[model samples]
Target: MPATSALRKAKLTVTISGDVINEIDEIAKEKGNPRSQVMEEILRDWLLKSKKMAIEKDIEAYYISLTENEKKENREWSMIATESAKRTWND
Candidate 1:
C-alpha cells in the first residue's frame, strides 16, 4: 500500500460493532499502523473485489447473450489459439 500522505484524506465517522473495532485495532497494532490506515486498506480491498465481481457479471451476461452459432465460433477460435500455444511451447 502507498503512504497515506500520497492520497487525499477524507474524514468521516461511522458506527461499528465493538468486536469488529477491536479486531481492527488489534490488526493495526500488529502492523504498527493507525486504525484509520487499516480501515482504508480494508475498504480499498472491498472496492476492488466489488469491481472485479461487476466485471465478471458483465462478461457472463455477454456470453449468455451470444447466439449458438457465435458460441460455436468462439469455441473454435479458442481451440485454435490453444493449439497454437501448444505448438509454440513445444518448439
Candidate 2:
C-alpha cells in the first residue's frame, strides 16, 4: 500500500449497539472530539494492534518451523546480544 499524509473521509452507514454508542459518546465528550473522531481513533488503534498480533504470530510460526540446530543458534545469538546490551547499559 502507498503511504499518504492525508486522511480520507468517507460516510458509512452501519448499525451499532446502544451500549457501544453510549461508550463512544462518553469518550468523545471526555476527549472533546466529535463521535466520528473518537470512532476513527479507536478503529485505527485496533487495526494497528491487530496487525502487530498477526506479525507476532507469523514470527512465532516461523520460529517453530526452524530446525533444532537453527533454533539453538538463534538462542545463543540472542543470549550473546543480551549480554552485550547489559554490558553496554552498565558501562
- Worst ten in a row by lDDT for model 1: 1-10
* TM per prediction: 0.86, 0.81
Clashing pairs in 1: none
Per-residue lDDT of candidate 1, residues 1-91 (tens digit): 9888867698999999999999999999999999999999999999999999999999999999999999999999999999999999999
Local accuracy by lDDT, each model: 0.98, 0.95
Q: Which candidate is the best by lDDT?
A: 1
Top-TM-score candidate index: 1
Candidate 2 clash pair list: none
Candidate 2, run of 10 with poorest lDDT: 1-10
Over the stretch 4-86, how does candidate 2's per-residue lDDT look in tens digits? 64556788888999999999999999999999999999999999999999999999999989999999999999999999999
Error of 1 at 49 (Å): 0.4
Model 1 segments more than 4 A misplaced: 1-6
**Model 1 lDDT vs. the true structure?**
0.98
